[model samples]
Target: MARNREKEDVESRFNPPVSISMADSSISLLKLISILIIFVVGVVIGLVSSSHIDRYFTFQGDEFNFKNTYFDTEQFSHDGQKMVVNCDGEDCLSMESFVRLRNLNHRLRDDELFWRASFVPQKEELPFRRVPRVAFMFLTRGPLPMLPLWERFFSGQDVEKYSIYVHALPGFDLEVSNSSVFYRRQIPIAACRMGSVSLVDAEKRLLANALLDFSNERFVLLSESCIPVHDFPTVYKYLIESIHSFVDSYDDPTRYGRGRYSRRMKPDIKLADWRKGSQWFEMHRALAVKIVADTKYYTLFKKYCKPSCYPDEHYIPTYIRKFHGALNANRSITYVDWSQMGPHPATFTAGNITEGFLESLRNNGTRCSYNSGKTSICYLFARKFDPSALEPLLNITAQVMGF
Candidate 1:
């Protein structure tokens, strides 16, 4: 019996008997309370963790396209609206009622849909119609302050097809008139401070918003100070009828040319690797989507890109180089004198703008044509013009610039 008792004691010490008996209520109740406390604590912890996780991925007010095009979730409240704008098919009744449509991920599988796209296109290839209208997007700080000169250039019989979008600084109450050429047409705008990446942001906002309502096919980003070197029809024919568009990555082995991609855009899509030229570029609607929807590279740009390095000059060209370099003719259409460096291009003075200079500008160099219709790579516009230089440009527009 003693031997049996000793073995029982050893077993009990090694593996204590669970006192989960109703008769032993005190210990059992204590254990039940402890278990309940533990469960409650776990529940609280789980709830907090769940909330934190949900908030992590919650969508902010800022939107992204389903397929990186202009189709935003919030732009249209109702369904069945037609796509009034596109690169291919002429402005006609769209089969899909834009309001009823919800798919943000629509991508074309056909080629030739974008005339010259590197990626997916629509199945039903649309033919090139009578020269497509080009939208000249003038990104400015507003008032135009020089609208009268631009008015003379834009107000002609052949200018009916083309449209203009003005992106101005947010605060200024733009001096607009009912009789002014800019009546009733203010583009969706974001604010910008000079010599900042916010300029790129403003440009993107302008493009994306215009993509919603405008029918103009080709997009040219012009500044408030820009002036037409040629007429609207000539510029239109130059781009549409040309074999390729002018979008380039100005790579200089001796120096960095692309200013859009900042030093911060590295490891994922570095400035050096994804380099592009200047802020002034002519882009197709298709390329615009790739730019705004570029999370892979753009996110990196947002993190590392800063004010000092001038990412605006480099990002666009670098991205185009990586994704759509081939679509471009690899040259910029807007004329700029880059020989003088720093914050901006050389501002043209009135004395500098002469009839001879106008001729030189109108026939400065040959442009590459994708249209197969026009001969020269027509420089649609030139920029960094001083307000005073406006007089000379206007004086010679009839002779040199078709407008």
Candidate 2:
């Protein structure tokens, strides 16, 4: 009996109680189950997060696709109800929001993308009445010293008949009073150098911005020095009633003309197709859309047309002549004196602002056809006027220019 009790004690020391062992087993099983549950939840969360990230980042090529999705408006606000969400330093918004919010205040920075996106055709006619307004686009270096004259010209005119757009250098602002016609008229501009494609780019930028307003039926390219030769009524009646766009396109066999043509502009633009014209132009809406939407010819000129080959002087003329020749009047409405025979046109001064000189400009002995009828009123505007001419112009604007 003593030996048996000793063996049992040894066995008890070696092994624990059955009840305690069963309790430990239960705890171990519980721990395993908890660990498995935690791992499964972690995997599920990771998968969902990855899917959301992919959807947010990827932009599929489809109309009204993920590219148009906007952030929650409650969290982000800009320009009233719309908000421009910045994703990796890019503006992203839905088509609905973009159309509602897009205006002159918003800048279209990317040239290639803007051109491509804006090239879309309006298949359906406008749903509302479009009052045709002339868009006077000014491509200038900086300040408009002649703003007072323009203000006077635009003053008292029906506001619905005209719209003004100024394209000055980037970071340069136009100083005009709240009551002035040029107030808040500046558009987003790019840096432009003389005798470069960038000048053409600036012009196109102006056209694109003006094209934003569906009511703009005519586009006139102007400079800081350009002034109205005729009254506002005469100019408006001439342009608004015209059948053809006034683009100064003519063939010149001289070195300045055909010599500027490059053999590289072959197949697409032949020597016969090449023409020259004034940089200043007044074009109809149809032609304006064509020039803004063009990429094939623009690329050619940007690459081949260089210093001597001024794209500003040749690109529009040649392009219009080749494609839309019938639509153009083949003349510039802005008169410039090239008789001096230099790299630049003659710059008129305050002394040149005389009534006789203005009369000659209005009727320059060039009986050009206006709406298929002969009219002495060939030039509607004149350029290269010195800033000093502003006072004299304002002095005689009422009596001589008739407005």
Candidate 3:
């Protein structure tokens, strides 16, 4: 009996109690399930927090996210009337309405920024239905001496078909009759010097202002010295109906052309991409928007194309050729007589404003490629007319120039 009792005690010591083993296994499973539940709950909470943070800012379409860039989401709203952004067919904002909402106190130094901020990338194409008009943008220094001639030209035409925006020097005021076409048409002015980047800025400003009007389909950059050689209807129809824009883009490998290229402009503008042309451009609405919204090429030109380089002459030509070559005819309708000596074109005085001279300007010039065919009557306007020639122009415009 003593031996049997000792054997039973040894067996109890070697084997573990079944109840304690079962309790330990159940406790381990419970611990693992609790850990899993905590992990799942943590993940759910993180997802919900992130979703709420993203919801604080409302993104407009996929293209525009003006939440925190230049404007605040709150600034876009006022007194419960939420600002509605209407994008045109080209995916550009209607600048008229946009400017109204913008904080004028916080204007940026870069005008191009305004245009870039207003750009909205279009996703689905919408049906386009708007009667388009021409925007005759004039870049001038002070008074438009040829206003009388322009008044005669635009006299009988429907005002709805065309719009005029003039950019002049600041603080230079002119007496404009209410009956005149240029009356009350001057836009906000900035000091612009010839052959400077300021000229390009003024040009872009004019374009930006005209873009506010959705009806403007064509943009023609003109000067105070410029006068329409063709009548209002004729010039309007010619510009609006044309399939390609009239921009004089040519490769001048000579001293004045390729020599103007700055090495700093490289990586963005290569030597092969160098171009030169007339500053005056008549572009379709699509190209005009692109010009206003461009920051890349404009910045390059502003830094590189300077005094002798002439940004006004080089910027548009190189930009258009590099990107929108197919949309251009590579010619300018404005006639400039560079045959005379000096940097300036031949300026026509009162003595040179005869009917024959005007007629020659109308149809007697070098042949140019128009609509894929050569034409003799290519010039639609002429430049560098003396202020004194205004009366002579007025005298002969109705009889000879057919204005």
Best by lDDT: 2
* Regions more than 4 Å wrong, model 1: 1-131, 158-160, 253-266, 270-272, 341-343, 365-378
Question: Can you write out model 1's per-residue Cα lDDT over 1-403, one digit (the tens) per residue?
Answer: 9999999999888876576444577878899999999999999999999998776656322234322343443445476574334323233235432211122112422122122222333554543333356667778886674677777766754544666667777775555778756664565455677656677777766565444432445778888888778776677766665555577576655344444344555566654575547688888766776775565665555566666546677667777877787777777778888778775688888989877887777776664455544445446677788888877777777876665
In model 2, which regions exceed 4 Å deviation? Answer: 1-103, 116-125
Residue 143 in candidate 1, Cα distance off native in Å: 2.5
For 1-403, candidate 2 gives per-residue lDDT tens digits of: 9999999999999897999999999999999999999999999999999998877666343423444444443445655666555443225444433332234566457575346436544666755556788989999999887888888888899887889999988889888788888888887777899999999999998888877666778999999989998888888899999999999999999999999999988989999999999999999988898998888999999999997789999999999999999999898899898889888899999888888898888888879988879889999999889999998888888888887
Q: Report model 2's TM-score to 2 decimal places.
A: 0.76
Q: Give the clashing pairs for model 2.
A: none
lDDT of 3 by residue, 238-352 (tens): 8888888888889999878999999999998998888899988899878888888888999999888888999888899999999999999998989899987677899989999
* Top candidate when judged by TM-score against the true structure: 2
Prediction RMSDs, each to the true structure = 14.4, 7.9, 9.9
Q: Number of backbone collisions per candidate, in order?
A: 35, 0, 0
CA lDDT of each prediction against the hidden true structure? 0.63, 0.84, 0.80
lDDT, candidate 2, equals 0.84
